[model samples]
Target chain A: MTNRTDFPPPNANQQAFPPPAAGNQVNAQNIQDALEKAVAPKVINTSNNKNDGLNKCPRCGSTEISTQPGTGMLVCHHCRYVFEVAVAVFKDPKELIGEAIGTGAGDITIDETQVTIKCQGCGAEVVVNIEGSMTSRCHWCRQVLSLENQMPNGAVPDVLLPFLLSRETAKQHIEAFAKKRTFYANSHFKREFTTENIIGVYLPYMVVDANVHCDIRGKAGDVVRKYTVGSGDNKKTYYDIDLYDIGRDFDLAIDNLTVEASTDKLNVNNKMNTNNIINSILPFDLENAVHYNGNYLKGFNSERRDTNINDLRGLVDAQVRDVARFKANSTATKYDGGIKWESQDMDTKGSQWLSAYLPVWLYSYMQVKGNGQKLLHYIAVNARTGETMGSVPVSIGRLLFVSSLIEVGLLFLVIIFFLFLVF
Target chain B: MEALFAQLLDSVDLTQVLAVFASSDEDGVGAVLLLLLGGPAFFMFTYMRYRNTDKRHRHEIETPAEMNNLQQYNNFIKHLTRQSSSTITGANDNVVSGSLLSNGGASKSFKAINDITKNFK
Candidate 1:
C-alpha cells in the first residue's frame, strides 16, 4: 500500500478533506474516514476574477471579444489584438488521492436565472439574464459586461473547449451525412431538410480522472475433445472440457472519462428522442481546453450543468467497474468456453471531477408522426475533431417496397438457374 | 374389394416419382428453399442496415488499453465429458455477480472503496 504522506499535497485552489491525519497507515478506519470525507462536497476555486466585471482586451481595454475560429486566441474586434488563454491544468490520474471537485461542478445552490452585475464602466447596475445570455451591454456607457465569476447556479464551468471547426465546416459535414441517407429518408423530412438551421452550441460535460483497483474471481472452461456419436440423422457432437478457477488483480489509472452533465442529454430514451446521437460524437480534445472565459461564448449558446458530483458518483463507479471487467476479460482469452465472473470488485482509490463546456455543432428536426410516435432527430458534429453522426427519419413504406423488389428479382434469378440446370 | 385395391396400387409408377426427385439434387432443394424465405430475410437485412446507421457509436462498452500492476491466476480443475447435443451449456457464461450501479435500484454489495489490502493478503 502506498503511504498517504508520500503523495503530494492538494492544489492551492483545491480543498482537501479528512486531513490524512492518520499518517501513512492503510487500515479499515482510515479507508472509512476517507470514504466519508469524500462524500462531503469540497470545491476547487477555479474562478479568475482579475477581469471579473468586464472582459476587455489588455492592449486597448476593448470589450468586443470573440474567439478566433479554429484557434485558442480571443480576438478583439475594436483593436484586433488577440489574447491567448492558458490551457487549464489538472492533477495527473495516477497522482489523484481524494475527491477534488471544481466550484463550478458543485450543486445548484441557487435558482436565480437573472443576475444583476454592477458595470465597472459606468457603475450602473445591469441585469444579465444568465438563462438566455452570459453577457449584456450597459445602456449608460454601452460597455459590454460579462459574467466572469463562478456562480453557484451552475452557469460557469471550470474550463471551456473553444470551437475548432467553423460553422461552415460543420454545416458541410452535416449536409454530406444527410445526403447519403436521403434515399430512405422520410419524404416530409427530406423536403424540409436544410443546413441553414444549424447552430453552434456548447454542451456541458463532467471530466473525471480516477485511480482504481479491481479484483475478480471466476470459473473458466476449455474444450479438450470433440466427437460425434450415433447414426446419420440421430448423430450429435459433444465436448470434453477442463474447468479452472481464475482470478485477476490489477490497478487502473483512468484519465479524462467524460460523461454528460445535463439531465436532458443523459435521458437516452430511444422512443422519445435520438439523444444518443449527440453522445456518439465524443472524445473531444480536452487537453487543449482553456480556463473558462465568457468571451469565448460570445456567439455560441451553452447548456448549464445541472448535475452535481454526488449525482454522478454512481454512474462513474459503474463505468469504472465496466472498464475493470473489460480488462480482466481480455486476459481470459484462453478460456474457449468463456468465463463466468462470480466475484467482481472495484475500489476507486481516488477521483477528481471538473466541469467543462464542450463545443458541438447541432442540427435538429422533429418528426411529427412516425409509427404513432414523435421522435426528434439530431445530427451532431464534434466541433473539435469534426466527427459527425446523426439519425435521419426513414420512410418505412419506401424501404419495404425496395426490399421486396430486390427479393423478387433474386428469386427470379434462382428459378432461371434451376431451369437451365434441368435443360 | 382387396383385389381392386391391389390393382390400383400397382398401377401407380414408383420409378417415375424417384426419377423426378433424383434429377433435382441438393442444390435444387436449396434454391427452392431460398426462393421461399428470401423475401423476409432481405427485407430484415435492409431494415437493420438503416437502423444501425442511427446508432453507430458504442463508447460505453469501450475501455482504455493501458493498465498497471496486472497479476493473473488460473488453477486447473477436474475435467468431465457429457453426451450432449450442444457444445456449450451457456448457463454461467458472461454472468457478473454482485450488484451494479446501473441496475436502477439501490445496490447492496457494491462499494466504491472495498478492502484494498485483501489482494496483498
Candidate 2:
C-alpha cells in the first residue's frame, strides 16, 4: 500500500509549473473578501452590487469607469489601470496573477492553509488541503478545479475517501457470490478456484436528481386458448389471460441516480460493478451530506468524480423510468400489453452539484487460466455501515453444500413430474 | 426485404392469397405453396448463411472463457450505459490534472464538499 506521505512517481515529459510564495500572509480583509467571494463570486450586472465595487477607475477615481481584461490585468478603460487578477490564482507560484481566467463558475482566492475556489453564483469557495486532497473547486464557482488541466499541484483536493476494508474483505464477498454459481458452472472452475490476486479499486460514479412526467398510451387485449381432444383419458384444461386497453401517466422525482463515466479502470457501469452490490449498499443518506471538509478525509483514498453533469443525463433517465414504471403499475388483473409513450415531460429544478467520498471496502484477486487471466475484484462491504453485500468467488466449502442441495432438489422435482405424468 | 415483398404486394391482394393458403383445401395446395415459398426461401437462406459464418468464426471457437465472458459483459454494459461509439472516440488521451487542481493551498472542491457536507451539500 502506498503511504500518504509518498507521492507517486511523476510522469516523465510532464511540464513543471512554479509553486506559491513562502511567507506569513495575513489579511483578515483578504480572507473575508475571499470568503465572501467564495460564497458569492458572480457580480450582478443589473443588481445594486453590480456597481457597488464599481469605484472611480482606481487610476483616477473616475466615476465613469469600465472593466475589461487587459493583457495581464483588469484594465479600467477610463484610467487604464492594470491590476493583475489577484484572486483565485490557482497553482501558479504567485498568490497573485497577471491576468483573469474570466467569469467562470466562480472566482478562487489562495491562502496558506487552503485554496478557495469561489462559485461565481454562490459565495462558497471550495477549500482543499495540500497533502491528500486531490480535487478543488470554488465552493461558490461550483466549477470544478480538479477536472480541468494545468491546475497547480496541491491546489487540487482537500480530502480523499481512502481505500479501506483491505484485501481480505473482498475475498469473503467473492467467495459468497460464487457459491450460488457452483451448481451449473462448467465444474472445472469449481475445482480450480484459487484466489491468487484480488485488486481493489475505488470505482467512479455520478449521482443525480430529476423530476419527470410521463404519458403512455397503448392497445392491449385478453388472450385465451382452450383445446379439447377426447378419448376417455385424453382431456385437457384451458390456458387464459385477460388483457385491456392500457393508459398511464405518472410524475416522480428521483434523486442521486448514480452512473459511471470512465472508459477504462473501474466503471460503475461495468459488469464487475454489476449495480447489484452497489445498489445493495446504497441509500448513502445523501440527505445527511454536509459541506465537504478535508478533516473528514483523514483516512481514505478517494477516486475523483470524473463524470460531470452531462454524463448524469442517461443515468437520471433510467432511474426515472424505473420509478415511472412502478408508478404506472396498477393491480388490475386485465392490463397486460405493450404501452407506447406519447410524451414525456421532464425538467430539473435547482441542480446542485455535490462531491462526496462514498465509502467501500474493496478486495480483488486475479486468477490465471490456461492462457489468460481474470480479475476477481469485490466490493465487499458498505463503507458507511460495513454491511456485506454479495460476492463472486465461490468457496469450495460453500460450493459443496449448495450444489449437493440443488442436485437433491432437482432429483425430487423430476420424480414428482414423473409420477404425475406416468401414473 | 419485407419492403421488397411489399412492393410485390402493392398491386396484388395478399389477403386474398393468404385466405386461399388458410383454407386447408386440397385444391389450394399449389397456390398456397407458391405464395409461401418465396418469402420463406429468401429468409431461410439469409439466416443459414449468417449462421454458417458465425459458426466458422475463429474467436468464438478459440477465445478463452474469461476473455469471452469479459467481452460479452462489456458489450452488454456499453449497451446498458447507452454509450455510443462516437462517445468513446478520443477518450484515451485526456486525463485529469491533479497537480494544477491541488495547487493554491486549499480552496478546491475536495475541501468544499467536506466543508458543506460537514453540515450536508
* DockQ measured for candidate 2: 0.02
Model 1, residue pairs in steric clash: none
Best by DockQ: 1
Q: Write the per-residue lDDT of candidate 2 for residues B10-92, one digit (tens) a residue.
A: 33444455554654343434453544444433333332221111111011111111100000000011111222111122221
**Which DockQ values do the candidates obtain, in the order shown?**
0.14, 0.02
lDDT minimum window of 10 residues, candidate 1 chain A = A1-10
Score residue A73 of candidate 2 by CA lDDT: 26
Query: Which residue segments of model 2 deviate by more than 4 Å?
Result: A1-204, A220-242, A261-280, A330-353, A385-387, A394-423, B1-121
Interface RMSD, prediction 1: 13.6
For model 2, state the Cα shift of residue A126 in Å: 19
TM-score of chain A of 2: 0.46
Per-residue lDDT of B79 in model 1: 86
Worst 10 residues of 2 chain B by lDDT: B66-75
